[model samples]
Target: MKEAQKIFSRPRSLRNISTHYCGGCGHGIAHRLVAEIVDELGIRERVIAVAPVGCAVIAYDYWDFDCSEAAHGRALAVATGIKRVRPQNIVFTYQGDGDLAAIGTSETIHAANRGENVTVIFINNAIYGMTGGQMAPTTLLGQRTATTPAGRQIGVHGAPLKISEMLALLPAVKYIERVSLHSPQEVLKAKSAIKRAFQSQIDNLGFSMVEVLSACPTYWDMPPKKALDWIRDVMSKEFPLGRIK
Candidate 1:
């Protein structure tokens, strides 16, 4: 019999369990990318992630590393405290658009301004995935949601909040990039951006963030494939991909 080579297997840093993400949700892909980067950087032992109170609220259940739960919109605050106390550990926060931009805006901006040595993986799915598809701070103008049945209006809802660009204005911010999970090519780019963010923290560059334009099929009321397409066609226009800072 011919010897078989193992071409694929789960990353050591990722837990082997079923995820609770909705079908076609980009959280799963984002989670895998983080785990892969952690394993590749050999920082699994020292990685401490602060999970947010959004769609990825139970993110600690997926990643096989030290994790702490934070109150709604408090992931960055918790991560800041953890990093300040234990500068030796690799600290990061996994948050969603609702958690980071809506309620946690203050913490996000202040953390970047202070140049805190922490990595932030921000998933911008536009809608609040964990909260019955409510409109999020990043939700596109004219997009419909549970709270915006008549479609988001410029006068009523205002424009979508470009939080990534806002944070890039801070001098203390080391790196800021926006990536998407609409296609395989974009997914690879997202991984690269995430890795760079993590590496920035490792190099003590301070305040690295990667804003990933992810998909929420259930909220969007679209099929899995259509959700990905919508990201590439519609979402990317508002939040273009590339390094901002």
Candidate 2:
């Protein structure tokens, strides 16, 4: 007789095709992780994901969960509405630095401060990706993007926005952490954090967030290795991976 299939299995949430993201883009990894969690939690039938404009704008295509396309910078508002009406469904918003920290800062902040019971997967790659390399709210000091061609200087452009830290200060935020996918170890930590964030909501914990310091090799004008090195040596110092509060 054939051997029984292993208990472990892959998620059906992912599409069976090569993604359109650039090589080494972290969104694909994050999407896979989220999808895995959805399947593991057996919420694939009831999970609803909200996608915003940015590299993650088309996340719906890759994830098999029910998804809604929100206007640029309006994902949180849409997510809040869905969760309010359908409290039984698990709601998550996948957003990039440009969408979450820049254009949608108000929406994100209000959602967290209001103690909204939703999961936020905020990807901070430092620069804009989908709209070409441009400065984002998380863009580091002295980093060049389309808007900051000569590198970001605080005297002119202002300091980078540490959104996770800022949200951690809000009393309504129950759990907040930052993790990276730079290595296998870090990937495990991120997976744990993502799981906790979801479990927290399942317990009605409120406003949990995992700020993932991702890499943007294409926008940084560097190869995948150097982009990762930059994330380790440069970005980590400014953003610092781990629980902020």
Candidate 3:
């Protein structure tokens, strides 16, 4: 008999086409994890993803399922509508720091507050990767960005928003977890958190979200490996990992 396959190939829920994400960017990993969960749960056919306006706005091109585009910071609103009308569908929204935490904070908070039965895959890369490395709500203190050339200052930029923790206080939010992709161990943990988030939806639980601390190497002006190290050494301090609920 042929030797057992060492490892499985890419999930069928993900297309074979190349992505436009930068080298070492965590969006690809996030996409693969979501696709893997969808495939494993046999929900690829029922999955409906809301692709918001950001770095992942074109995510529909990579995922092999029904996907719709939402205006800037409006992904949660659109997803709420879709899930409300098609309660049977597995609805999820993929959003980045700028799109979700900055412009879409109100929608996200309200959705969780209402306990919407949908999953949200939040990519928190600290800086806005798509829009010229500008400062985002999640950008760490002292973090440099195109908009914060002198480094983030509390007097002007205010404090970085701990969105996961803020959302965890909502009564309707059934589950909330913050994870990172800095190392292999962290990646595994992140995947596990993502799986649980999806399972929460499958069980018809209230709002569930998995905030992934992703890296933006190209925008951060560092090599991919160094960017991962920064996430582990510096970024995690501002946004600690683990379940909020």
Candidate 4:
């Protein structure tokens, strides 16, 4: 019998502990990808992640590196300060749709506009996962949520905000890519995009962000498999993937 090769293992930058994300939630996968990228780049010691106040509020618990908890919707601001004070550190912010596109809109825009030397990991699950299933700024039009039980209406709720596209228009932004976690191939692409985002910051290139179209099965009220399917079939249509800038 041939010995089994160790094909996969946990990333050194990731702590050996279970995450609090709900089943089918994409946060875990995103966390692992970040950890893997940090390890690959050999920057775990110098990396500093700013955790958001949404579903990933306790992200510090998973990453085996320096992390800071920011006020709700202030992750970018916090990351900006850290990166400025410690110019040599690899700084990044992990934020959700509500935190990034809604309450933190100003911070997001200003940071990118200023060309802050920091990476941003924006998780767009379409709805507010941490605080009930409210309609997030990235929530697809006509999508049902706790606040929009009858489905989101254009005239009343307005159209979904294309934040990534808006950010790409800024001259200071060096890179911006929208990726999804619905399929294996896309996951690989997401990892690549994330790595590039980090690399851009490392090279002292202006602001870089990778918008990940993650899934929220519990909030979506769908099975894990169905939730992933929705991200591919339904969500991707609204927020198409690729290098936006």
Candidate 2: tens digits of C-alpha lDDT, residues 26-71: 8878888898888778888888999989988789899877999999
Best by lDDT: 4
TM-score of each: 0.98, 0.95, 0.98, 0.98
User: With candidate 4 superimposed using the best TM-score fit, by how many Å does residue 194's alpha carbon deviate from the native?
Assistant: 0.4
Sort the candidates on TM-score, descending order.
4, 1, 3, 2
Instruction: Give residue 68's lDDT in candidate 4 (0 to 100).
Output: 100
Tens digits of lDDT, candidate 1, 30-130: 99999999999999999999999998989999999999999999899999999999999999999999999999999989998999999999999999988
Q: What's the CA RMSD of model 1 in angstroms?
A: 0.9
**What alpha-carbon RMSD in Å does predicted model 4 have with respect to the real structure?**
0.8
After the best TM-score superposition of candidate 2, give how far the Cα of residue 51 lies from its true spot, in angstroms: 0.6
Which residue pairs does candidate 3 place in steric collision? none
Overall lDDT per candidate, in order of appearance:
0.93, 0.89, 0.93, 0.95
When summed lDDT is taken over every stretch of 10 residues in candidate 1, the lowest stretch is 6-15
Reference-based lDDT, residue 150, model 3? 88
Better lDDT candidate (2, 3) = 3
